[model samples]
Target: MLPAPSSERWKPLRAGLVDMFYYDQEEFWFHDGRLLLRGNNGTGKSKVLALTLPFLLDGDLAPHRVEPDGDRQKRMEWNLLLGGKHPSPERLGYTWLEFGRRAADGSEEFRTIGCGLKAVAGRGIARHWFFITSQRPGAELRLLPDSRVPLTREKLREEIGSRGFVYDRAADYRRAVDEHLFGLGAHRYEALVNLLIQLRQPQLSKKPDEKLLSRALTEALPPLSPGLVTTVAEAFRGLDEERDALRSLADAQQAATDFLGHYRRYAKVAAKRKAAGPRLTQSRYEQLGRDLAAAEEAFTAAQQQLDEARGELTALEEQRAELEARRDALRADPAMRDAERLEQLRQDAERKEKAARDREDDRDRQASQVRKYDGRAGQAAHQAGTARDKLAEALREAADASADARCAQQHRTALA
Candidate 1:
């Protein structure tokens, strides 16, 4: 179904008719509501009032309207017999109605609705047709009548779909009329039928109160015994209640098709309880229990995996602590400290050995100087010895001179 549109998206999926196109393929037919059906008195006037219109519109033969064991009524249905007399066996009958449609601005436009019924292959029931789109056969039945403009068959479907609401094996043709043209609801079709039945002048028309409800309405009126009056009123009330119930049931199931779609959707069981109203299915409890069991098993397996991971993590933490303690002890070990201390001791020893070698070189230089000084001391000693010898020789010469002077003095003294 096409959803209702908004301001920006106001294109209606189905449009209303603007006016009636009196024009058909042949010529113009209708002017207004005046339709002349030529016939004699005993022909179909009584049948039209008593049988035909009710059959076409309502698909009902009211029990009150039926006579006692009439051979004709017993043999076959009045409407079905009419369809069997059609020229074609497959086509039970066809009906069409043209109506003026409303335009967007409230002006009149035109549209035609066509319907056909075909008998089911071997069954007594007839399947109705639906005109879903304004295409092909739809175009053939519905037309835009203008004298100058010629018609062309371009883009249109040859026929409607096979089945809609598949379980709804009704006179499908009637559904199209019920939904699009006229409806079978209290406000629409039934009310209209009541009015039509009222139109029959009581003096001429036979089979009054075709449905008990009609007579029931009148029974409560005029002067009557009190007990009888109460009974009549009760009957009228019951009849009204029954009619309302039937109308509500129709509204629930069939009438909402265009708006909410098929009846079966409403009858479905809900998948979840949280959802608003469409009740639950009765047969699937054991399957639901099996699903719950599978879910619980999956959850248990996940929980076990989590527990195992936690156990492995605890072992890993303990192992890491042991490794950390070992590393700290290695850092504090004697060998490691000794290795650093040994490097410092080696550097200090190398410095002390270099100083000792420098002291030994200085000693050797002083010894060589002492040897040179010793040689000079020996030369001075030799010179001193020579000087002493020269002094002694001079003293001796002086002594000898003194001795000769004394001898000369002695000789002079001897001459005196």
Candidate 2:
């Protein structure tokens, strides 16, 4: 990731920050186990190193530990929220260091130590949690899920679930880091931190003081354990006998050295005379031995590969057979056939039900037509009855008119 630190074994491969300070995601690579920060004043060069180098290991977010100058005004919360510069009222961030070492066989082991900071505006640091994991960020792990999203404490815990531990207390975190990273006890780790702080003092480079420096160095050394002290005392009690044995061994070594110095001159001529005869044979033998070793190594590698391939083939064949058996069983199952038959029956029933509904609709339409015809027939009958009544009235009127006419004729003849 950042030009992979020098191939040389380095405990601290890189240090990084995610959503911490002015950095969204920033990684500082170490060259030959050292990192150099260069920038103008107030560029946070010191702050970056301070937050990562020893602070990540110390798990102390205190101002003194965070700022090299021990500035009391500088706070961890300010780094996260940027003292109101950030828009969010709350913030979460991480500062982590990746430690790695290469084994003799060229295999690599990594250990990561990080602290998650929760800062709330006006609330200082709301929470501080630390984690140590073997998972490497940007590789097996990612501290930020998105380009701009940092992991919260719970999210980090979930991500590192079972792979590592996240500690809420700084003491536990420090103890775990010391044990895992440095193999140091609490007192020794405290002394080492003190020494580091003293060495990192800004003024130490400007004005070197021999006496004060000596005193600080002395104070930083952890006291010897009682058991070690007792062992040393016991060793000294037998020192006189060891000294006599050492003197005798030294005398014998000197005599052998003297004898060998003379014997080398005689042996050198004899070896030159004799070695020429078997030189070619020895060379051929050595070459054959090397070739045999190479062949053996290749054979071993090929055998291992063959074994792996065979194992994979066997597993795949077994899986195929198992799948075939499952398929056959499913095909033979009576329940499956019954389910298919039931599905077909259901489809037929639905089709018949739909046909019945269509027939009912047709019948209802025909009934509506019959009702209309019956209403028309009733209106016609009413019209015919009215016409008959009119005709009867006209006939009665005609009869009455004829009678009136006869009466009028009689009256008229009399009036005439």
Please report the candidate that would top lDDT against the real structure.
Answer: 2
Name the weakest run of 10 consecutive residues (lDDT summed) in model 1.
15-24
For residues 198-290, write the lDDT of model 1, one tens digit per residue. Answer: 444343245445554465344323446799889999999999999999999888877567556543554343213222221111112233335
How do all models score by TM-score?
A: 0.28, 0.51
lDDT of every predicted structure (CA atoms): 0.39, 0.74
Which residue segments of model 2 deviate by more than 4 Å?
1-10, 222-416
Off by over 4 Å in 1: 1-30, 41-91, 102-115, 119-126, 129-139, 142-188, 194-416
Clashing residue pairs found in predicted model 2 = none
Winning candidate number (TM-score)? 2
